[model samples]
Target: MAIDLLKRVDEIQAIGAVPKILETVAAMTGLGFVCIAHVTDDAWVTCAVLDRLAFGLKPGDELDVTTTLCEEVRDTARSVIIDHVAESTQYAGHHTPRIYGFQSYFSIPVFRADGRYFGTLCGLDPKPIKLSDPVTVSTLHLFAELISKQLDAENRQQAARSDLSSERETAELREQFIAVLGHDLRTPLGSIALGADLLALKVADPALLPVVERIRRSARRMASLVDDVMDFTRGRMGSGIRLNLRRHDSVHLTLEQVIDEMRGLHPERVIAASIPDLLCLDCDPERLAQLLSNLLANALVHGNAGTPVHIDARQQDGKFVLSVSNEGQDLAPEIIGQLFKPYWRAASRSGSEGLGLGLYIVDQIARAHGGKIDVTSSAGRTAFTFTLDNVRPVST
Candidate 1:
């Protein structure tokens, strides 16, 4: 059978305040037994208790509703106080006092924040004490009010947490949708690029050649933009950029390929590259190509038009280092701090410069290889550098 949910709810509401309240009940009233209880028609359950007399009562323990004095307070919705149960006319013959063997009894009906009667905060002792005193009864009343306020605050906090959980789930769904859409668009984009290449061969007219070339260039640019979008979605929605590192005979081949592709796209811009093979790379080839491509594009657009963009890849000691340098005005310190943040673009550049995910993707790729990216710009010379561990990947 399922547990009694109402009893469990009462236990939760009393978690923090009940312990202090029970302690206060005994210290102020001089009662040997002090407890917070949940009384209903069928059961009387202990929420919390200070059992100085070895009462053996703890939270969730139950007594028959018919046998406890708390049940009378629950039914009448009033306090029950007998300074000396043996001398009082009302409780002298009462079986509850005789059964529990208590001479002094004190119990007050406790209400919830919503003004509904919940149970009782009760205390009892074998010896008769000053329960009839006004100061003692008022102290019990204040504690019951304090417990009600605490329970109300807890309920509000729980509701806010539930709302936040729902919002997080919704955000995850939106990220998935963006990733799926980016993947689906790639097939059609590939067809556009292929069709441009086919038309260049068929249309031999010199006048139409430039138009075909433009189509090819536009298609290539669109593909690059698609790549940026995919990386952004992955970094935000997924864990990070995944890597498939392998030991290559030479890493120079991929860096040279990227330089050649950059030259093809921007032939007018001067390019100088140095790739002296010093170490074999244990890295992801495709991701490395993408990393260099982003750096080259940034250099060609932002660097001085007449100066050459320098690309260098070499092994320094045991670590592999790849760097790209160019002539440019020094970037502000504030801008450098945000260089690897996604979608953070320079205000001087146009929107057509693409979503500013290039450096962020480059940073993620380097980190996947247990490497880091560093950049410095000053005195008309700016360089972006990447350092990789150049170690072999152990097979899983």
Candidate 2:
């Protein structure tokens, strides 16, 4: 089947994990060059590449389909792994190895969910290395499968956007996304986190610790993105945020812990917290912690760094009131109105920091708790207060 090569390239890039996958493949297999290519009947195009051997191939770059083994994979629907091209009887005299001057090579076919061939996750190294280990081969194959599943997710998301006006279709799409995000996306991330933990335990080099930490951090960040998307899906699908509500006498302690954690994360910035001991109230402690974390993160990103963000949590007039305020430029009333909407970012702060669902999730949590978040911005001060009605505090 013919495919739009440009659109395919964009789809691969949008997965956000392709580059990391390529880099991880290279590191794992000791391959100098790794890439995810779009293989078709008459064309072989690089969709994403990690070039450590100066192979010089980049995204959108093309090579003659006849000269690449990926085309052979496309034809046979099988992977080709040659640990040592010079010693392998099957490919000793192959023209591809001779032309590309590679002693090690592998091309694993990636397929869509419906079994249609998409492309190959291929790598090559000039020096011969053991690439045929059962674990190594299986890991690479798993990576290819991850790409295929992510491609399905990207396609479904595009379709969902196109069918926004159709309520039934939108619900189905949300379910599809929830499944993909909950399983396909998070499964690999959990593996990455586990691998990082194992690597940290085994590696003794002090200099390599930071690299391990970075891997851990990236894994955490990706997991967080998955979580945000899942919450957003649940919130928008009209089910609302799920909560584990229970009575707690020391909810203030959880709020204080969240503030302390944020302070530790951003030592350069000041966070003024006043969380007094409060009587028992009914709420989801874990969900409230998540809510506070999201609010603090939002303030830290959009709030002024020079001034301290003030957080006050206490009972007020038979109601539970928790407020977070920061000194910053007053948000326009129009902008403030849209602050709780999903995927909304301010024009001045359009960056790749988050998926812009933090505030939206916060709003959902408030609603789930039979409360509402009110925003007030004036004279360089903005506060977000959550007030849950009919909070009759009981004695501990």
Candidate 3:
């Protein structure tokens, strides 16, 4: 009977005439009437009904949904039938027979596809009758199953819409963040460039030259931060940037270029570098140069003035480890974890010149090249180490 009702409900849903079909089913069953009631607040409300003999009852009627019969079906997780409403002890005080003039009632619990109870499909009659027919009971049960399937389908559609909304919100936030980054970086960068250009024209004051160089270095740092933000955005959007990889001397050429740039800007600070002569690696040269420049600049800005900043490169365990160390205050353990996160600055630093994107860019570059980067700091020294693929041949 349950399977048959489910099949009928499917047919009703396909036609989008469940109310008409339900009414027809009730009238034809000869049980005085039939009703499809939805459970709400432990009470039954008529959603659809079939009554042709002017029984005075209509659709959208409410009844005691929490009565013994309904509660019994729900609690026992099965169907219930009251053949004679007056004689049945369970239906004595129920409002069905007393108020609505219903003497015979048969109700099957409706369940969703996941087997959660949703409501009930019931048949009613004013005249006393026996509800012992197996075929009738089975049909009602089947109808309940059909209702469950429709409910399941609607729930799935709602969930899909919710997911789509969440995705749209995420995209909007990303766009807003990018817009703010562009706005913040433009003004400082322009000021730094203009200041450096003006300083280049004057040669009389030696002290002013150092200040001018600082402005230029700071401007370059801001530009690098902007680039990192753009790259990270591109990566998140699934448009992977193409790496311009080339064979280059890892230690000799790259470090020399980086050190030369830093030295030209920081003439007073001693920068020491030791790189092996013939070590070569396949990597994006521009990215490696930027990485080194960022590390060196960070050391100059944060490390103690006049203290030597050391750059070391060597092959260790079939990988090339490049390290930059300088004399600086030790960083707290908590700060180290967030060092590679964008826009995160250490508490010890002041004068927010860059967008804290240096270490983050280094991390991204290393990961893209199948490598890694890490740092160690103490009271007197801080070091950043990065690794790249060792493309050099092993000597016998």
Best by TM-score: 2
* Candidate 3 lDDT over residue span 72-121, tens digit each: 66777789887788898877777656866778888888777777665677
Error of 2 at 149 (Å): 8.3
lDDT of 2 by residue, 1-396 (tens): 235998888989987556546655665566788899998889899999877778899889889999988988998999999999989998998899988999999999999989999999999999998789675677788778878877886777677766656646644564554546445656666777899999999999999999899778767766776687778767666777999888888888889889988887789999998888764679999889888999999888888889989998878688988899998999999999999987677896664356677899999999999999999999999999989989986655
Model 3 error, position 47 (Å): 55
User: Could you tell which candidate, 1 or 3, scores higher by TM-score?
Assistant: 1
Best by lDDT: 2
lDDT values for all models: 0.76, 0.82, 0.67
Where does candidate 3 stray beyond 4 Å?
1-173, 176-222, 240-242, 394-396
For all predicted structures, in order, the TM-scores are 0.57, 0.65, 0.48
Pairs of colliding residues, candidate 1: none
lDDT by residue (tens digit), candidate 1, 266-333: 89998999998534777889998999999888888888999999998877567888999999889888
Worst-scoring 10-residue span by lDDT in model 3: 8-17
Give the root-mean-square deviation of each candidate in angstroms.
Answer: 28.4, 7.2, 27.7
